[model samples]
Target: MSPRSASVNEELRRRSRERLLQATVELVGERGYEATTLADIADRAGAARGLVSYYFPGKRPLVQSAVHRLMHMTLSEALEREPVTTDGRERMARAIDAVLGLTRSHTTLMRMHMAGILQAEGFIQCPEQQRLAFLLEDTVTRYGSEQPEHDYRLLRALLMGAVVALLLPGAPMPLGSLRAELFQRYGLEWELGTPPQDEEPAPR
Candidate 1:
């Protein structure tokens, strides 16, 4: 093949791989990773299974690549966007709003993330899991003191807990209110707009 033709072929291959990866992300959200076979991904991408096998070789690697794509695409990068500052208070409010917005937007992917965690031991080990845990940790750690590592950890745990609560069969908890309460309990009071006004009674 001529050099120009080879370059065009390479570009097409790159696009094909990207489409396959995207297809995997969407399909995994619709049907959890376990239910999503290589054939399914191939069909969704409109490519043959041989092409998927050529690109990814196996199911686990494809899923791992998809997970990495998701981590970098949605969760990890959400915190790094340009800040709309109106002092620290507004920054904090914007941050919280951004976080909640990301959570809502990627609910399905988040569920697949949780499901992957639950079944992680089957085909995944500590290294991959720890990387993700630390990504979440880093995002939380951006908000406060160096000593607040534990607080960041707890906040992520609480966020995941809230997601699970909403996923349960029963009526969803007042998540917005519950999240606000959790934020207050963890020193997010001033960051999320002003606190409500109140008065105390005097003793007789």
Candidate 2:
């Protein structure tokens, strides 16, 4: 083949691969990782099945890529909503508010992440998941002046669990009130007066 033709083909393939990744993230975020298939991603991305296979090798890689994209997007956006502070207590408070706001805004995406982790042990064991967990741990570790690592981990776990439970179906309480209580329990009483924002997280 001619060099010009080869270069054009390569560019097209690169664009197609990126589109597939984007489509996978959007579909997984909306439907779910398990529910979405290669066909669906191909259609959404305007790519061919053969091309997806060429780019991703298999479904696992595609899912992993999608998860990585989703996590990075969520974390980047979440980190931006509040100012960075050095004081551990203040930072922890801001982080709490940021994370809670992120969860509330992107319940569907958060649910997809939770569901993915629960259903697939291998998937959850991926390095991206480990990295994400470490990021959470690091954020919480900053608040460990008087508390032990175990205590901080426990508090973080409890806080995350409460948020999930409150968000799950058949919970008979108001989400707003429940989230407020959570923030207060975490010593973030300052966020109580802030109005709710309507920004949703990007799809998985």
Candidate 3:
């Protein structure tokens, strides 16, 4: 058989990395961060254990990238979902809902991710994270921000704060309240995006 071309090799590598990320999300979500090992992730991905180390310096970075990938995918889907519109307010609303929704849907994985961020490693600026940043920046631009980069940073910080608040142990705030604050900040109507079934809480 002929040797694989460079493009084929690159594609293969991409698929391998994605499998590891997907496996990391699944295993960590199921077993929690401490209980899930790199070997377990490799086995779940059907790849060599060494590949995990090759792609990531350690378990923390690997899990961080995996969570970022999940976030990017979730945000992309929400922005491009059926009945899509380029309306900035709508897109911003979708973006907020997308990240906030993850806290509820992937509570364990998200909690672990937040914990990792607080560690010495800080935020991992991996490709998956860059992609997520790009999407958010674009949303900020569409939302008519004069300083998109600055606004993007502010938006990201707010979302992160909201996520942390929702995941706070034994003292979690209500999701509806968080959503309300975000919508008010962005000038989004309560009807935009996928609002929770509960009535919007009155302003504090």
Candidate 4:
């Protein structure tokens, strides 16, 4: 049999990496960060342990990238869902809600990822994160921003702060309050961006 072409090999590698990333997300979310290991991720992905090292320097980096991949996928699906609209306000609201939803659903995994980010490396500039950033930037631009660059930074900061607030230990803030503040910041209505059933979304 002929050897696989470079394109085929690259595609295989891409799929392999994606599987590992996905498995990491699942296991970490289910088992929390410290309980999940590279071995577990490799087994879940059905890939060899060596591949984990090849794809990531350590568990922290892999978790960060995996979470970013999840974020990108989550945001992308929300933006491209049925009844698509070109309205920037709607898109921005949807973006906020999508991220907020992820934080709520994957609180354990997201909290660990946040802890890792607060560690030495800060945030990894991985491809997944870049994709997430691109989508958010596009959302901000669509939201009638006269300064998309500035607006994107502000939106990202606000979203991060809200996520942190939601996941804070002991004194976690209400998701509705955080959501409301975000909606108000973008002048989004309570009904926008997968809004919850709460009457007040604003932070008290």
Give the per-residue lDDT of model 4 (tens digit) for 42-123.
9999999999999899999899999999999999999999889888888988899899888778999889988888889798
Which regions of candidate 4 deviate over 4 angstroms?
A: 1-4, 202-204
Please estimate how well model 2 matches the true structure, expressed as its whole-model Cα lDDT.
0.61
- State which candidate, 1 or 2, has the greater TM-score: 2
lDDT score at residue 117, model 1, on the 0-100 scale: 56
Models sorted by TM-score, best on top = 3, 4, 2, 1
Error of 4 at 68 (Å): 0.3
Write down the lDDT of every candidate, Cα atoms only: 0.60, 0.61, 0.96, 0.89
Best by TM-score: 3
TM-score for each candidate, following the candidate numbering:
0.57, 0.60, 0.97, 0.94
In angstroms, how far off is 58's CA in candidate 1? 6.3
Residue lDDT tens for model 2, 1-204: 999999999898777877887898778768866788999999999887788887776676677666655564554455445554545455555545555554566566566655554555334344444655555565566656454556556755665675566457676344456555655666654443233554222222
What TM-score does prediction 2 earn?
A: 0.60
- Model 3 misplacement above 4 A: 1-4
Q: How many residue pairs clash in each candidate?
A: 0, 1, 0, 3
lDDT of 3 by residue, 1-204 (tens): 345687788899999999999999999999999999999999999999999999999999999999999999999999999998999999999999999999989999999999999989999899999999999999999999999999999999999999999999999999999999999998888899999886565677
Winning model by lDDT: 3
